[model samples]
Target: MIKRALVILAPGFEEIEAVVPIDLLRRAKIEVVVAGILPGVITGSRKIRIIPDYDLGDVLEEHFDCIILPGGAEGAENLKKDIRIKELLERQILKGGWVAAICAAPGCLINFGLFLSNKFTCHPSIKAEIPLSRLEENSSVVVDGNLITGRAAGSAIEFSFEIIRQLVGEEAVKEVNRSFLSNLPMLGSIRKE
Candidate 1:
């Protein structure tokens, strides 16, 4: 069976956090649906714009193996304020599907009371917004039960890899990483000029 993933995109989302995982997941043959909270194009925190495959309303009834949230301060705030996103998350969790959030996006999970007992990681700035006790400060990514949280933009690749590892497997991760030349030993034996 093909794994399906839904990635929610809000205005001012982090582009790298959104795109990197989508790209890698597709490479692993996962069906990724990028859904915009609003209609049409969504702009990133860094001013990058993306056209989502579906509007949130259009796919609310659809079932997915995973739901992902990419973080930016404004984007996370938008997600936090959306009742639709909260409902979807609750349903997804109840269905035993994966819930992944990165950077400030984890704030949305906290807003929904999903992180009360889960160890998670998020952008440092979000620590002030969420309880410090539940935050895993030393990890780039934290996976507790079906909830996966990533630190910040810098952890995008590793975050994606962890997601890939979950839905797929270590073999799939090895195959995908091999294709991207990731996780390979550096040729330190070669000297550069």
Candidate 2:
């Protein structure tokens, strides 16, 4: 079956973090649903506006293989404040689905009181807001069980590759990177090797 992903786009989401994963996952044949937290056109931190394929409420009852979160400082904060986002996160996990967050977006997970484990990474800028013991400081992308987290916008591609790997397979990742000509493919980390 084709994997499905719900990408929650808040008012100030990071454009690259949101788009790269959406692009690469679609290239890998995953069904991606770009959903806005609110209705109509949603604006990013850099003022890029997007018309989401669906609104968050429309898909609350739908089952997705994964839920993706993209971060901007304001975007993360916006996501954190939404009770619906929290509901989706909890429901996704309860139903054995995955959740991915990048940059400050992980702050939403942390702030919402979900994924209380000590194995995630977010942009260092938000470190002060998170407990130090839970921070995976060195990795650009950290995958802890069903939760996938990435450090920042620069790590969005890496973060996405990991998600694709989790949903599809390593071969799909290789094909995706090869297709994208990604210098940072979905193989074992260059930093770790």
Candidate 3:
């Protein structure tokens, strides 16, 4: 069976973090539902607008293999304030489904009391907000049990592959990576940051 994923998109969500996973998951043949937290078009932190596949209310009763949260400071705050997001996340967790968050979105997991003792990573700016004991600073992505967290926007691709690996398998990840030519390095000469 194809894996199904629900990616929650709130206004001010990080565009890359949201899009990369959705795109890659689709490429891997996972059914991705991009749901807006509100009724209409949602704008990203950089002002990119996207129409969601469904509104959060429309999918409240739907089942998914994973629930994904993309982070922006404002977006994460919006998610944190939504009782419905909390409820959905808790329900998914109770059913032993995967819960994934990136960057500041991990704050939502933290706020919802879902972080528990799970090791996770998030944007450096939000590190102080997460308990030091639970932070895994060395990796771009951290997966503990059914919980998956990514460090920042730059790590979105790697984070997404990890999600695919967990839901599908390493073989699926290799196939997707090959299709994207992700195994190949940059075409041009490397430039130092």
Candidate 4:
């Protein structure tokens, strides 16, 4: 039922964190839409310019099956300040839609009061922002309920894989894993015991 995955980008977003998942999701034949926090171009922390497909002001809250947030200090801050974005996250979670954050952006999830008791991992520097007990150290990705998180940019690929698995299923994950030759040390690479 999830045909499209919507990614929200703001100024100062970590370019890798935002782009990797978009790329991976697109490769899986999933529709991706990059939504801007505002109505203009947003620059990543590394100075990568992203032209969003839709602006926040113009998007309907119900159009996306998933919403992803990529971390960069300013990007996280931008998402937090938008009440509509916050409301969308909450509504999406309640509707059983996938919601994800990577790196420092997960702090936005925490600040929105969405991270309590969720099993998640974030950049070590931002760990204190989340109130999760079952924290995994040096983890690439963690999924708790409808919320998924990745530690940092270094984990972006695996984080994206985790999202792919969640959206499309293990078969798709296996297919992608085969195509990418993903031998990286991440949760997705581990064979289930």
For residues 80-135, what per-residue lDDT tens digits would candidate 2 score against the true structure? 88999998999898887999999998889888899886477889899777788878
Candidate 2, superposed: residue stretches over 4 Å from native = 189-193
Candidate 4 residue spans exceeding 4 A from truth: 132-134, 185-193
Predict model 2's lDDT versus the native. Answer: 0.89
Off by over 4 Å in 1: 184-193
What are the per-model numbers of colliding residue pairs?
A: 0, 0, 0, 0
lDDT by residue (42-104, candidate 1, tens digit) is 999999999999999999999999999999999999999889998999999889999999999
lDDT of 2 at 129: 70
**How should the candidates be ordered by lDDT, best one leading?**
2, 3, 1, 4
Per-model TM-score versus the true fold: 0.93, 0.95, 0.93, 0.90
Tens digits of per-residue lDDT for model 3, 13-79: 9999999999999998999999998989999999999999999999999999999999998899999
Predicted structure with the largest TM-score when compared to the true one = 2
Cα-based lDDT at residue 173, candidate 1: 77
